[model samples]
Target: MITWMQRHKKWLVITIWISTIAFVGAGFVGWGSYDYGKSSGAVAVVGDRKISVEEYQREYSSLYGQYARAYGNQFNQEMAKKIGLPEAAVNLAIQKNLILSYADDLGLTVTDEDIAKELVKMPAFIKDGKFDKELYIRVLTQNGTTAVAYEKSLKRDLLLQKVESLFDINPSSNEVNNLSKLLFAQDDLSIQILDPKSIKIDYDDTILRDYWNINKIKYMSTNSYELAISKLPFVTVSPTEDELKEHYSKFKTDYKKEDGKIKSFEEAKDDMIKVLSIKATKKDALKKYLALKKDEMKFDATTVIFEDKLPFSAENINEIKTATVGDVLKPFEGTDGFSIVKLIKKIDPKPLAFAMAKDMVKADYLDIKRSEKINNIAKEAMKDFKGEHLGFVSRTSIDKIKGLNPNEAYGFLNKLFMSKEKEGRIDLGEKVVLYKINSSKLGTDTTTQEKSVKDILLRLQKEELMTSLIKNLENRYEVTSSLDNKE
Candidate 1:
């Protein structure tokens, strides 16, 4: 990509060429870094309860750990920012307190047995398929907690779970069947992926320049940046044997031996040590990031021009492009550690000269021409479109569309079902898919009507209802956040 960009540097309104931020890294090597602060004394007050410093740290860690698990090595600070994970944690903290406050209003309470049942079911507390109280206390003690404190935290978690369950009433059979019909109804489809290569255009310098002039706004120079960076190198923190065992006990299901049974602590020790190292690095990275943000530390500067690709992810590049000069972004992961980045300069996009823009203009011209041609063909098309034979597909036939991706197929199916027309053309940027519905029938395939699909739809139905319930709950309570410590 750099070779291609360098070859066409004259016409480059900087093409988007780099990655977005993710876990802590400086030279772009690690999963990512987080930007949460240390829990100072007391934090936010919601209803009768205060979001204690410990609770604040725990919530942030829980959310961060979940993202790290889900994305694995690909997870980074940029992805976290994109997902608004930190904000989600704050909002979740607020929501939990709101629910607790409302639960109080409704006389909802959690008993000691409820806490016991939940704790006993935890894998960390179970031994030989039974709840072992001695093992439970041991794990807690090793992790620096007593049973009393653990039980108190468990009680709050259980109460939140119980309260949320009340909002998820079971969906009716009729509701499930309606969704099943949408997903299972079979349709005979004919598809044609219109290719840009098929549309030919004889071009001259004059013609190309004219096209560029007509669509000047469409062509621009690449947006670039100059930045100051502070890298927090990954420090290998060797966790104690007890720490590894505690981690294994807490999340034993994550480690699997060859036979698929949970790995013994000894077998999982090395991997668990690496996990602990990554976590320790994240906290250190956050501290480094805060120091940089407060101007307590600084780093030498570097240029991130259009041609300097692969140094940052595409997501982080876009973030830099969108940000103004003087903005300090949270630390993104490096090859060895986390980087606290400050944008020193932003070179805004400018129009590309005709010499530089000729190739791009020609490409865009061909694509637009192809789309127009295909659309016209689609208007006259009443029968078959010669491409791939997609036999029969349901509205949920995500995997069946041969020429398009699952997301493309989903969008097309939704459009196909929504339209009253027998045929239509859908543009998918590089190509166009002209689809014709030859025949249709009510949902009949028992094979497609999977129980799992129904359950997913049922969950979807409940979530739709729950979204509104959450909004109503938010209005019922006044949530004050001290998470950011802003007056």
Candidate 2:
């Protein structure tokens, strides 16, 4: 079922024309930011259509805001760059423009009546189960979009949907039947596993030094920081039962047992008290931070490593990284209490000398040597099995193999199913398995096979049609992007 969903998801994305505002607004944080020229609001020109800065900004903000809320301080500029959010934003805009451009070339146009009908049917634009013009206008205004612009966007989306729906790649009954047999077929296998750790490798100072010289960058020093930190302990504030109960009432749903039953106030009293105490301490911590900023309060400073030695979190470390020396960050909750942290010093990352990184280099060298040795062992094992020295076991699911870890079992099973060779030795880091298939048979359950195949065939059709349509349309239309020069 999980595999079926994974296969069908792309088809669903291609076919469904969801609510425009909601689709654009949701997960916009996944795209970073794009800059259209200040002189013109357009970011990119596709054929005759222009993608506006307003549209880009709106979608980017929505997507980034969602990530920020979910990730807290973890979603920094560096993280955004690593995820290619900016490029993703531009691609999304380009895809939209491509569809719209194709629609325009085909002379597709939506009437005001068509837009009106769609708008009225949308629950977001309706009040009292009926169309409400005032409500619609107000909602659009609140989202920083005008009714005219939104309507225009919606019309384009509908036209694009109409164009996309024209292609069909649905399979025949015979095709489904053949596909079903392939999908439901199960292979019976005989197997033996070899442990990599059983083999040993010897290492000396010379070997370690040589390894360090080649991979010195891997042994680089992380950024370090000097910080002046003061704590506002949450236990200092005593939260009364009444206050705790009030806080509990506001967030009662969160206090749930393993059985899904809501934990009573009595069951959650201790936790509530601690949380309320922390909430009160946050105010005092802020006051302390303000005084620290003004140099009215003194804090004991300590040198801390920015990466592995962090007393707070990666998110807080990133925040500190952005701050200049002498800048004080506001109070944040840590393991013990609310903390006010001031940036006292910053250290840039640098590679360690070979002498200093010898131990780590030795460990890495051993890991590489062991992996190589294991691969060689597996190859030899395969040769021996082919020579018939090793006896084969009966048929069993790859997952049901004795003594293999769950992760290794699933991974090996997936690999075995994907492999073309009937007999081979698979290397799985910790252990290697030698496998040989005796027979393969399709599933006997007709109803399950038919239903699964039908669904898979439909998904394949949708995917094939979508891919062909995109390629044909892209070539058919003139496409251009100013993504390289977003500013």
Candidate 3:
């Protein structure tokens, strides 16, 4: 039931930015570019560990890449600057080195054997069912990294893992039971579902006018674009057996069948060939794009479009919208083939007038009035208590409520259990749950896996331990950061 390693939950302030690492090679970018000098290159120092400019750049890039993937074309260098990604990156670097410093003090070390084992398991490095040194070299070289620097980074990561494992506690049977009982406690209850529709609204025109006046900017016309579009004809090319095999070796994980088994070379060959073709054809696409950029090649078509009705995918459209007028976006994936786009014009959004946004304002106003009425009605009902009796329900009683869906039932139950008050109302979006607890008792469900409960308890313990340990480590480690130093 414990599906993942506890050591994987490494976070100082719950790191939302995790590197989308495909290959160890991807992780090693920029280690080859910088000099690990005595002073100039270092951004921050955590005891003996100097966070170099190259290291800071890699961390910053990793964080940036995550945001780019999440927000698509909305993320840019300017946005990154505004979000203070550099500071976040430095903080993350400091936390990592802080943990590493503690690990060193505790005499923890990641051996050559440890790093070798990790490398063999990675899908990128493995070729022909083993760690291929030549393939590793090629991948690393392609990614602009060297083995020495990469291994050092690996060593640090492994060392962190080793340090994390020290706090991995196995909860005792009694401990698991105690925690499970606390988490899944049942409650005797009187329930009242407060649907907003039950409360009749006056639906005044004055309320609409007030709401429209206050929130007029909420209703705005979307930013439109006038774009010059050109589609690059789909390039289909046959891949050599060697090229297919090489691609397969690099990305074999994606070639898995429905049964979770890796497909054979013969079985996955076509898809592998297509992927390689896409990679190869992009080079030609880029060449064509260059000529197109300089206006040597003319556009095939043009369109003036709103954001909602984009020609390309939202991700691709995002790229187009962000570019300045006359700036060309390189070949992005399209329905037919790769397409290059130039932003000829950009139209800024304007606030919609009251006449245009009246319907929207009315709907919003009605909802606001309905919520106010629901709260007042729920408060009175809680005092009088003329609601239906829904006997004992635990957090696990996800199917106990008839009107509420599984998620709503679980949320209401969880809220009720966490509450110290006997009578309360929980606002669940469109509906409100008003409940009065008659009695409470610990749940006795042995059908669920006790190992899962143990895992949960242990995870919580580890989280608390890590939080405390890291706080103590702030005093234990002497950290100095000059992240302001030129990168």
Top-TM-score structure, candidate number: 1
Q: lDDT of each model, Cα atoms only? A: 0.65, 0.68, 0.74
Angstrom error of the Cα, residue 150, model 1: value is: 2.9
lDDT per residue, candidate 1, 379-480, as tens digits?
666354555567778777888887678887788788777778777777666666787778887776544565766678766666566566667877776667
Ranking, TM-score, top scorer first: 1, 2, 3
Best by lDDT: 3
Measured against the true structure, the TM-scores of the candidates, in listed sequence, are: 0.64, 0.62, 0.62
lDDT of 2 by residue, 1-487 (tens): 3345335423323233223434423322212244455725677777788887766664455545545565666665555544555665566666677777777777888788887777777787678889988987776654446777777667766776676666645678878877776665677667777775666789889878888878788998888888888877776557777877788879875564433245688998876776667777787888888888899989865656646677776567778889899889988788788888888888888999888788788778887898898777667777856422223221225446766887888778778777899898777876878888877776554556687679778766776766676678678767777776543
Model 3: residues >4 Å from true position, as ranges?
A: 1-97, 109-181, 197-215, 238-269, 272-297, 312-322, 353-366, 441-455, 474-487
RMSD of 1: 11.0
The model with the greater lDDT, 2 or 3, is 3
Candidate 2, run of 10 with poorest lDDT: 387-396
